[model samples]
Target chain A: MEKVLQINNLSKNYGNIRAIEDVSFEVKKGEVYGLLGPNGSGKTTTLAVIMGILNANGGSYEWFEQPFSKLSRRRIGALIETPNFYPYLTLWENLKIVAKIKDADEKDINNALGIANLLKRKHTNFGHLSLGMKQRMSLASVLIGNPEVLVLDEPTNGLDPEGFAEVRNIILSQADAGKTIIIASHILDEVEKVCSHVAILKSGDLIANGRVGELLSAEETVYIQTQKPEDLIKSLKESDLAKEVYSSDDDVAVVLNTDLNSGDLNKFCFEKGFTLTKIQVRKQSLEDQFLQLVK
Target chain B: MKKLFNLEKIKALSYPPFKTLMIIHFLLFFLVILVVSRIHFSIPGFSVKGLYQFPNIWEFFPWVASWFNIFLTIVLITLVGNEFSFKTFRQNVIDGLDRNDLIKGKLILIFTIAVYTFIMVLIAVLIFGLIFGISLLF
Candidate 1:
């Protein structure tokens, strides 16, 4: 697949504060790439630099393997923070201005409104809409002109469960239509659900980067208790199936490497003439894995 | 630039307070011209009447009109500030309006307002002088 975006050793500083340092990641075409980190971990700053809202202090980036330009930006839809609109203007009027700016067909306004279910409230003033509605309206702008890629920062911020579900569905539908997405999010569950790949950031540093499944599936904490504790420890140490083995109270804890089945480990220990008394496979949630990575 | 200016004009219409400010700015422009042109005073045998005359009209009109340019400045600032205060300026950039396009839009608005006010002053002074000037009738 062609590279949709590539960032190399990108860094930014705000006064004396390091906002992002040595951040590097590549987003391929048609993938939902997530920039996942806690608040103040440089997620927003990274996104701002990627969307060209802020100049990087060092390094470079490319979109579609080409230099950034208005033409390149035209093919991308983005929402950085809060929804921006004239408060006194009705929702439809706000969208009309957005459509005009985007050079999009007027008809897409209705399509976007329909998708966001804001058609009924189209005539309502933007100031009067609920926070969720305001978020949905901003999200609707992304669908205008059907841009090929979307760069969204905290796209699901301030949304209710229903609003959250709607936004996720819209993103999935966009991806289904072969549109690529780059999303910056502090919400682990949201990213885990939507992103095909993820880059984890901590304190302005890119700490982890890989496919979500690979990264999430990498940490498996397996617990096993054998009749012979010494044999269990020695066998686990000698066998490369699990690298991280320790004694936690009465049970021995071992972390299984990729594709190394707990069943296979149990069988190997049994074949070594040590019958397992208890075995437990614990899969760490994305949040747990993220916490571990951040740590 | 014209397209962007036109779009900005249309967008501004959606905000009623903006329209109100613009109306006040326009009405005040006319009112200032009218009041400045028709001033008449007499102090103990010294009389000054009809500031709207051929040469005086041309000379004094621009100066008077220039004062009212503040109205346009205020209106323009409010209009531009609305975009910044509401973060619509950033949104416009994100919506694929090259940042230069936004700057150009505001410039066109400023230009349009300046030229429009200038021409209004010219037209207003011409009518005032044509109706009451001493040059043609004297």
Candidate 2:
């Protein structure tokens, strides 16, 4: 796969404090890559550095396998942190400004607005719109040039549930069209549904990165209650059935190996003469996985 | 260059404050000159009309306009300050403009405004000079 972006050990600092340090990731063509992290975890800082809004303190990044340049910048449309448009300009006029910057045709303005569902409010000033509408307008601006890649930071910041679903649909449709996307968001469900791959960040470090299913959903943890919890845990650890065995309150928490399911572990426990009083299978939600990783 | 100019044009022209300040600047310049022209000196050695006549009007109009240059400065500052306050400068880069392109766009705006004021003062001088000079001939 062709690489759309490559960041190697990128670092950034704000005066005495380090915002992001030694962070790195790659986004390939047509891949919906998500930068997932909690608030103040350097998601916005990473995007800003790549977008040239802030200079990196150390290391570097490249677009399309070359050094970042104006031409490459035109190929990517980005919305970072907030919707920063001329508050006084009408939605149409503000998008027109973006169109001009990207050397896109004026006709694109309408198409972009239509896609964002802001066509009816085109003549309204940006400052006058509701916060959700402003976010949609930012999405509209990102679509102005019909760029090959889109970089969005908290794209659904102020949206209602319907608007949130609308933004997700737009992102999915864009991904379906084979446009590479890099989204920085703390919304785990959003990233889980929209991103093909993810890089999890914690306090400016790339803690984990890979396919969503493999990184977050591959493991299923089963909690079992037996007469002798410590003995069951010891037996499970001794056997090849469990990858990890620990106690969660009164129950024994077991993460079964890839080849073994909860059923296999149950059968093995029965064979070992352990009477299971309670057997519960739980799939870790993305939120749970995200919290665990960040924690 | 043309693209940046177009962008700046859309931003500035649509802004109400930009338009309002510009109009005020224009009116204040003309008002000062018009009011000063009306003052009649009792001293025999001096007359305000002399300042409005042919050769004098060229220098006099621009010098009078210079005092109001402060207003133009305010206008320029407002435009640039809005970019920072709104954080649109950062957005502009993310939208595809280079950092130098931003400075260039402001420079273009400044040049355009300079040209506008130059023409405005020139026309004002020409009209006032011909009106006063022709009257003196009679």
Candidate 3:
């Protein structure tokens, strides 16, 4: 797939504090890329730099191979932080202003509002809407031009479960429609669900980056049950290769510390006179991977 | 420019605060005229050095309207302040509206307000001009 957005070692600083340092990543066309990190970990800053909202101290970015020019930005949409609208204005009026600013068609205003699930509330005053509705209206403003790429920071933050679910559905559907999406969110489960690729940032540096499944699944843990659980624990302890070894009821949870084969662990346990009754290998989740990288 | 103008008008009309302000300002403009006309009745026209010193009720209208213009300017600046102090402008940037678009949108709003205010005041001036002239005849 062609690269839609590329950041080449972008950096930003606020006085002596570096918000982002040497951050580099590529968001491929039609892919949902997640920038997974904790709060104040440069997610918003990086987005600001990429979107040309804040001037970068170093490095460069390109949108659709056009070197972050004004023309290139026209095809991009972003919501880096909390967006606000006139509370006293109707939803339709707010978006009409946005569409006009972007030089987009006024006729497409209703379509954008509908996609945000706010068509019925188009005539309602913005101040009277719920938080989730306000968020959706903000999103509708960005979606007015039907841009090819979207950069969003915490798209589902401050939302209820239902609102989060709605945002997730909208993101997934947009990805399916061949739009490239870049989301920076603390909701790891949401990222795992919707993102094809991910970059983990910690304290202004990118420590881990790759496909969402591979970066996470590389560190699977195995659960073993045996009558000779004691002997199995002793063997694992002697090897010093198990990241975590604990017993829960009749089973033992053995996390692999190195890139060792699961079959080998089973074989090693069997050779040590332990009968492996059951073995369950679970894939490592995004949250676990994120913690490991940041830690 | 036309697109931006239409959008600015829609936003101003849709928002209750600005709409309310429009009405209040219109009334205030007429109120100034009424109060000045009332005071002009008791003033005596006097002649000094072969020159007529007429009680000019309309002389104060321009000063009142100019003060109103200053108030309008403050209100306009408040609109921009609302976006920044509330962080909505930053949010608009995130929502994919480009920087140029935002600047253009603001310019359009200011231009629209200037034009609307100028036209409204001009019409008021024309109406008052006829009224004051007819009163002199009677």
In the predicted model 3, the residue pairs found to clash are A77-B96, A78-B94, A78-B95, A78-B96, A79-B94, A79-B95, A80-B94
Tens-place lDDT digits, model 3, residues A46-142: 8888887899999998889878776676688777777577777788878876776567888878998888999999999888999888778777877
Best-matching candidate per TM-score: 2
lDDT of 1 by residue, A1-295 (tens): 9998999999999999999999999999999999999889998888788888899999899999998888888888888888888898888888888888878998999998998889999999999998888888887888898899988888789788998998888888888889999889999989999999999999999999999998867777888888788778888888888867777679887887678888888888878888888899877678977876786
Go through the candidates in order and give each one's C-alpha lDDT.
Answer: 0.84, 0.90, 0.78
RMSD of candidate 2 to true structure, Å: 2.3
**Ranking of models by TM-score:** 2, 1, 3
**Model 2: colliding residue pairs:** none
User: Of the pair 1 and 3, which is ahead by TM-score?
Assistant: 1
Candidate 3's C-alpha lDDT?
A: 0.78
TM-score of chain A of 2: 0.91
Please name the candidate that would achieve the greatest DockQ relative to the true structure: 2
Ranking by lDDT: 2, 1, 3
DockQ of model 1, rounded to 2 decimals:
0.62
Q: Any residue pairs clashing in model 1, and if so which? A: none
What's the TM-score, to 2 decimals, of chain B in model 2? 0.94
Q: How much is the lDDT of residue A269 in candidate 1?
A: 86
| Worst window of 10 by summed lDDT in candidate 3 chain B | B46-55
